[model samples]
Target chain A: MLWEKEMRVPNTAVVDGKTYATVLGMVRDDRFIPLELVYKPKPGDNVVGIVTNVRHAGYSIELNLPYDGFISSKFTRVSFQQGDLIYGRVKFVDEVGNADITDAKRLPAGKIVDVPASKVPRIIGKKSSMLNVIRDGTGCSIFVGNNGYIWIGGKGNLPLALKTINFIVANAHKHGLTDKVAEYLNEHGGDVKVPPREEEKPPEEKSGLSEPAEETPEPAKEPETAEPSEPSEGEPVSEKEEKDAGSSEEEKQNPIMHSKSAGAAEESGEVKKKGIDIEEM
Target chain B: MEKPELIKDGKRLDGRTPKDLRPVKIEAGVLKEAQGSALVEWGGNKVLAGVYGPRECIPKHGADPYKAKLKIRYTMAPFCSKGEHSRSGPNRRSIEISKVIREAFEPVVLSSQFPRSQIEVYIEVVQAEGGTRVASLTAAAVALADAGIPMSDMVSAIAVGKINGQLVVDLGKDEDNYGESDVPMAVTHRDKQIVLMQMDGLLTREELAQNIDEAIEASEKVYELQADALKKSYEKEERGKLKL
Candidate 1:
């Protein structure tokens, strides 16, 4: 009873006729999983976190991670507060253990938000351009982390910023999103700068069993070749991907028909033309 | 009352062989509002699994400061079966099944990762034939994964039983009524660890081992379906094809 494929756990290699599970390195341990599924903090990566606990030493923050992180008073200029949202950098990952936050700043007057970890890049735009749009338009300073935690700070445009970011987070998967976000920003605040058109840069991360197929394939078929090798390597794997892709196309054509994205459907009930048949819980 | 002959020659009542399983289909992200959900149709059973939370524990007291807690509820809809609508709420049998379901998943979920938070699972048996528990467990596993909860493996379950003195795989409702022994087994595939096992009626040592082996084999197929459903979900989400 051995699973050859998933047995990355050296701990599970049979010893004395017993299987002992191993907690492999959280990073690069289960290479099969997309990077979004595993949490690994790199030095200087921006992070947004909520203060889950306030200690005499400092505050423990939640980055939507398994472990609460500590932002030590070592570098804090202001007093730490509980339940407050903080934005900072991963200054150092004790790759030996948990990473410590440095240059931490509290965001007092704004909302802390979330998107699926996988969609963080989409919200951050092609290269922080999307994030910059939301920031400049709403006059909010936004920080997005690999964990999908977002800290949005602003007074004049706090509400607008939250709405815009929420929209982007909710509909991050849709195309023509940069235009949509820019349009919404301009309509709400005549002063906010709206970019005419955004350059859609397919990320450089699309190597290996990467997302080039699903992420950019909708608009262009050129990326299709990048994934053919993947499809051929494991025929069954590609077959499932094809079936899912087919079903997704079916849903897009008839969104109101059945099978809506859970995030979009959960946002509001009034969006439906038939309206009010299904009440929000 | 004449007993239904569960198997004739090699085929069962549904024309399935002794080792044949009921057809199973799974769809992930079936419910809105729930972080993750899935619907599974196996044989005549329709089960929906919904996952919510990893948020603050309600009642403010169910929190475990160190590890995320799991609450698994299994309910059989009142009209799930013929002629009789079950009363809503947790019955004794449902409670026991719920407990077992919780234990079945507790080992697989990376609950400790989200301390003091609770991830809840709601398994609604829209219809039940035989092996509703197994079907629901299968669906729950997918729903948990669909929710993007970290896990070592997805647990899959199937029931293999002795019907008309013949060991069979995936007993149907009719066969269950007349079956001499029924065993439901769940294993976390990556680990091949049996997380849940329950037996009803009787089996000798040798028969138990043999049937357990059959259950293990059947579970592998179940795992394939579960994995397929989960992968389909992420792929669909990736393509922005998800309606949400």
Candidate 2:
């Protein structure tokens, strides 16, 4: 049967004289099953957004959320055309869920897939260890958004990486998810190794949520390792993979590596305090 | 034209009873490029529906600032009909069906959710026995759902008609050519809200009410079949999961 409108049983909140139907545990209803997942972005969170609408002033980005977030004019210095993928930080998130972003860097060539929004934390895993395993195994540069959109970029093991990641997303509700993903990665990830991440120095800090991508660079990108993207072939990168590296000029600006080049322990503590790891909501 | 025998011993021309619907087979996710696609075979009718976009709206000016605009094309193949030799282009009948079908869907779709975008549904009648619109509407809803377009509910449809002075459900080609009346109807499967209703030929006021009521109830079966087709699409992915 088509679902009738749910009975609003008194649980609501009034913010600025506007009342919203807010249920506990992010439940659609206490009486009925949950049908939709609403993603809320906190400050310092990383999101991969697709540029949905563009104008001379700025752009509107779709973050797998219902409403599009705006990247205003001043931040438009880094030119982003419509349909470009932006690896941005959530700068200003309001009670009404509207967002204003800053330092919106673009993601290079990659395949993007969306999973159920609530399943996002499971993909990130505990302290991002599951994410590390997937990244290390496949030799793909991976970035996951709080909005449940995942971007994977690299060479050779793409299709297999996509299959394994989607599996984790699908079966996340089940327990022992990390172990299963690790096992799958170990068994099918092949013999290649990920090169260490290069922590190029950061530009002057701009705002509170400046450079979450850099602050939380994946463990796969280390400076000491010899070029993480290629383990087997010492050949030139494909045109597509090369386009993914951003303009060579911007490489000096170094968008994704933070000033804090210490190590993984620092990365784990910072992300945890930020309350990034997904929890059932 | 000879009025072919439509019912004998309370059986339809296809040897089914008046209340018996034609065998219908629906499959979802049939086309690769379309966001969602479905093919439905009801009786002798074959209808394929493909849904694309909620992407960008084209022609610039046609883009609605408040809601997604709908672009619908309901067409019949030149050789879809038997003996009569149907034409390839849009006719008065197809145009009317297209308009009503669009109106039927616009109410339930939450188009305002995707502003300045266009969602297009193309329904192609590959084989036409009768009740092409009903079959098309059924397939279109499945394709739209499979496309992950947000909707209030999926709609299912069927045709009710009078054949040989007896009320019948889902008329066959020969039965329709010889039948007295055809009433095509669709309802929101979740709310049972009547979305599309049209009558042709003639029916008593009492027969019209009764047939419309009966057809709505009979649509429950069609709704179940539609759900089964969508579920079957995901079932095929299990092997892909296990293989990994």
Candidate 3:
């Protein structure tokens, strides 16, 4: 017979005049289980945290959320010191100039979900096509809010959307969807394309101008195009000679150069020129 | 009490001749949280030992700048007593046994490395038939090593008792009471150093010498078992690494 073990949740405790639920339990991932907190913590709540850094008076706390929240020591309890996780509340949003957050408990739970920072771009999709489907399918009011919080969960679709979001976030970098996150969403379930947000347009325009300016002025771009064309010109004649010498060198170096400098080729060329000067000297 | 018999044909009461020892099984690092721990079984006798240590000396007043203090405590459960004796702190016999055990281990342990720190060695006798003190001391040494305490050598001990006027390697409870003499010795197995020697009842000098030789031989066998237990612990640690 299989026995099910039930854990008892602790009685409600008052913290800062608010009743908060606390349950002592184990947190399990694919690997080991760690003793941790299980509670519903909203944003802007006065919570205790440990000071991970004293210079900036910064402190971090698990907050019973998927990720830890950070706060400055100025908002900390009196005995606050470096290396101390102390108590603090959100002292209002800096953007709104509301330094008083004494009654900010109603600000809602800060989004705790995180995609690996490396994988965030994939879930956002190239134009956010994948993200829209995820938002629509799960019916989660999805918002990749600034400050690394991916706000998720709304009404009935909360659970489904959360699962899909977690799956996408966990494997975003692995599937090469960092740039085209919308494609990943469509492949998973949600078929709708999210309208590209206006915020992404500025960076796209900047890149478009920089790309033409760099390539149009460079003689190096022509050599790359000509080399491949020559291979097709005198197929058998050049094949053997090229294979024994030029082709081997080109093939061996192309992948190394492409993988290392694909995103910053112009900067790499400048570095290479300086290196040659130093070597000659 | 009946006198134990020994035949010219080389047979004993339990059907083993002279120079024979009871079966010994040793396991190290048995307790998860202890720095060093072990459980040893010799025939019917069972002993468990836990070693905590080289930690900061508590109470501040107990701190010594020159050498590490070895606190050896040997305790027996109520069930291990002869009858329904009330459980209490260390008895006179246990105090004497602890003193001898501490001496046996001192020469083998590199205590100087942990200056001013205290190494607490706790030995619990779960079941006792005979030769419990010697068994417990040997088990403690094994545990201390398993806890990663550096010791010059492993300590091995055994008891030799005279039954029916003949020298025997290890004594069982029945033979011990009826026996004419009993001798317990702890030896450092690596260097063959005699760290502990104690006896009760009378024996001629030559006879005592012979018994000592026999006890040393039996201890060497016990030392081999100790090494085997250490090897098994290392193998278990290796398996844990693979899982990680």
Q: Taking chain A by itself, what TM-score does each prediction score?
A: 0.53, 0.55, 0.30
**Each model's C-alpha lDDT?**
0.64, 0.63, 0.51
Evaluate chain B of model 1: give its TM-score: 0.94
Interface RMSD of each: 14.1, 16.1, 24.8
User: Could you tell which candidate, 1 or 2, scores higher by lDDT?
Assistant: 1
Model 1 residue B61 CA deviation in Å: 6.7
- Model 2 over residues A1-281: C-alpha lDDT tens digits? 10123232222222233222221111211221111223445454567889988876788989865457879878657888888988776677654355677767888989887764445656665445556667777778787776667787877478777877778754543334554566576667543233132332111111122222232324223222222221111111111222222233123222211211111100012222122212210
Q: Which stretches of candidate 1 lie over 4 Å from their true place?
A: A1-46, A49-86, A89-112, A125-141, A145-147, A151-281, B53-66, B83-85, B235-244
What DockQ results do all the predictions give, each relative to the true complex? 0.08, 0.03, 0.02
Quality class of the docking in candidate 3, CAPRI style = incorrect
* Ten residues in sequence with the least summed lDDT for candidate 3 chain A: A260-269
True contacts kept of 3: 0.00
* lDDT tens digits by residue: candidate 1, A1-281: 22223232221222234322221111112222121232435454567888888888777888765456778886788776778887776666542225688778777766666666655666776546676677778777776766667666655587787777666655543434565677688888724554644344323122222222333313332222332121111111111122222233223223221221111001011122111111210
DockQ-based class of model 2: incorrect
Model 3 spans > 4 angstroms off: A1-281, B1-10, B81-84, B237-244
**Per-residue alpha-carbon lDDT of candidate 1 for residues B1-244, written as tens digits (9 for 90 to 100):** 7767878979889899988899999988778667678999999999999987676666567678767789999998998988355596798889999999999988777565556667889999999888999999999988876676656556899998898889999988878878889999997775578998999989999999999899999999998787666545533433222222
Give the winner by TM-score: 2
> What is candidate 1's CA lDDT for residue B51?
87
